[model samples]
Target: MSLTDNKSAGEELLLSRHSVRKYEPGVTIPEAELNEILELAASAPSSWNLQHWRFLVVTEQANKEKLLPIAYNQQQVVDASVVVIVLGDLQANEVAPKVYESATPQIRDMMLGQINGAYSNNPGLARDEAIRNGSLAAMQLMLAARAKGYDTVPMGGYNQAALIQELNIPDRYVPIMMLPIGKAQAPARATERLPLEDQVIRERF
Candidate 1:
């Protein structure tokens, strides 16, 4: 089959997804389904296969209450079936050997050498790569949720410091984004998009 045929459903899911702020009050996502969605999202690509993304799924009412203030009192923090805190591990390169455990010894050594060379003494590059990988994982999560008939909203309006303290997040893990997933309470309003001609370039900007 052609790419178009293979991607028709995926395209629909991507196009139909919107940031859902209001969710059904009593609905909860099944644990198994949540795990499956997370697995799919974790399959997103990472630099050197480091896979630095870490998800903190908050679903308990008490924990959600604690996160509410940290999230600037966003109702979705409590209303959604689950709120996933997507984090990036700044020290992900430390695990380069483990990440390439199944590879041939020579390949693993080469990967480790490359990772160490690129990341050691380069905090800025490591941080950038972590954020980029985490962002890809977050987008994959949102699309995966949509494929499961769930609505989601990616949030970045929280107080990062407060969230870290409240959640007892490790220092190495940087908070990248938050996603609230659940069934929508109401239909999402139509949104306008910039035309392809305005945003796309054939060769040069």
Candidate 2:
């Protein structure tokens, strides 16, 4: 397809995506198919390509029940096929070797030095990178699921401390958001957005 055609297709996909909160209960997405979606999500860009994100997939009914209370009794937790806990890795630089495994030793070492230096100099940068890069993967994850005929909604209402404890999340990672994906029980709610002219920014505001 031509570039314009590709752009139209992209717009179509964006338009078709909407947050779905009511999923059909007991509708399971096969692990293999879900993995395909996850693989695509992992391709999202990261600072220094350290890939500072980890997915906690909650698929068992018992686990979902345990999560429901922490999420304020949101029914989507139990009804959705899977609830993904997107975690940001605060120690992403530790994976520098793996991220640049294909590069020459000298190049890899230099990149690792840069990654480690920036993070160590400013301790808060690790947290910021984790959240920012993890969020990019999360958005791609949602889009990939949608392209495969699944519905999802991004939720941030859960109790963070309880989630970490319940899921046994390690200290090195921070919980980013909870995303529930499955077949929707009903069509998603139609939404509107501000016009481009009103929302876009110009140079120097």
Query: Evaluated with TM-score, which candidate comes out highest?
Result: 2
Write model 2 residue lDDT over 36-81, tens digit each, in one string. 9999889999999888989999999999999999999999999999
How does model 1 score by TM-score? 0.93
In candidate 1, what are the lDDT values of residues 73-172, reduced to their tens digit? Answer: 9998888899999999999999798989999999999999989999976769878988999999999999999999999999999999999998999999
How high is the lDDT of residue 182 in model 2? 95
- In order, candidate lDDTs are 0.91, 0.92
Kindly give the stretch of ten consecutive residues in candidate 2 with the minimal lDDT sum: 1-10
| Structure candidate 2, residue pairs in collision | none
Evaluated with lDDT, which candidate comes out highest? Answer: 2
Model 2 alpha-carbon miss at residue 93, Å: 0.2
Runs in model 2 deviating more than 4 A are: 1-7
Where is the poorest 10-residue window by lDDT in model 1?
1-10
